[model samples]
Target: MVTKTIEVVNAQGIHMRPAGMLVAEMKKFPNCNVTLKCGEKTAKATAVMQIMASGIKCGSKVEITAEGENEQAALDKAAELFETGFGE
Candidate 1:
């Protein structure tokens, strides 16, 4: 398992488009268990609605976790996506 920390940088946060993108990326790794969290709220990264509902405002700190054989790569990719501002 691996967990990486990042801050939301997209001006609009993780809105619908970015949330869908994140979910789609997450779904590519079936053996992984992914989780996204902001402060005390956490949800499965596989769920678009749950991620959007996080209300993770810009600059909010977030934790991305992945557990599986490919945990490190999964976490790294997620961190890269967030660090890139979700392609904003």
Candidate 2:
């Protein structure tokens, strides 16, 4: 498993749109299992509502984790998205 911590840089934080985008990305890799956590909340990466519920505002640190055959790639992609603020 791999985990990377990053901060959200978008002004909107983790509203529905960005959350959906992140879920879509997470869903693209079936070979890997990905999860996210912020503060006291933990959720599967593809769980849109759970992710949104994390209340990960701009600058909030989030941890993205991945495991399985494609863990490294999955973690890299997820980290990229978070680091880019989901391409705000």
Candidate 3:
């Protein structure tokens, strides 16, 4: 298992558009389960609704985890998205 932390730099945070994108990306890594946590709230990265429901605003602290064969790649990619601020 590997974990990464990134700040939500997007002005709107992980809204529907980005949430959908993130979930879509996560779905590609079937061997790993991606988990996202914002502050005290955590949600499965595969669930778009749950991620959106987390209400992670701009500058929120996000932690992501990937566990499995490609955990490292998964975590790195997920962190990249966060660094992009979900493309906001």
Candidate 4:
């Protein structure tokens, strides 16, 4: 498993558009399991609704975990997305 903690830099946080983008990207790693943790909330990276429901905000710190096949690649991609603020 691989993990990285990053801050949510997008002004809108992980809204519908970014959530959808995350889901789409994470889905590419079918063999890997991606999870996001923020405060007391935990969500599957590929679940848009769960991600939005986590209440992630601009300054929120998120812990991303990727396990199983291609875990590093999955983690790297997720980290990149967060670092880029989902291209907001």
Candidate 4 per-residue C-alpha lDDT over 23-82 given as tens digits, one digit per residue, 9 for 90 to 100? 999999999999999999999999989999998999999999999999999999999999
lDDT of 3 at 2: 95
After superposition, candidate 1 runs with Cα above 4 Å error: none
Task: Residues 1-88, candidate 3: write the lDDT tens digits.
Answer: 8998889888887889889989999989988999998888999999989999999998888889899879998899899988977666
Candidate closer to the true structure by TM-score (higher is better), 2 or 3? 3
Give the candidates in order of TM-score, highest first. 4, 1, 3, 2
Tens-place lDDT per residue, model 2, 16-86, is: 88889888988889878899889999988989989888888988888988998789988998888878777
TM-score, per-candidate, Cα-based? 0.95, 0.93, 0.95, 0.97
C-alpha lDDT values of all predictions: 0.88, 0.87, 0.89, 0.94
Which of the two, 1 or 2, has more TM-score?
1
lDDT of 2: 0.87
Global lDDT of model 1: 0.88
Sorting all predicted structures by lDDT, with the top scorer first, yields 4, 3, 1, 2
Candidate 2 Cα deviation (angstroms), residue 27: 0.7
Highest-lDDT candidate: 4
- In model 4, where do residues sit more than 4 Å from their true spots? none
Q: Name the lDDT of candidate 4.
A: 0.94
- In model 1, how many backbone clashes occur? 0
Candidate 2 C-alpha error for residue 39, in Å: 0.7
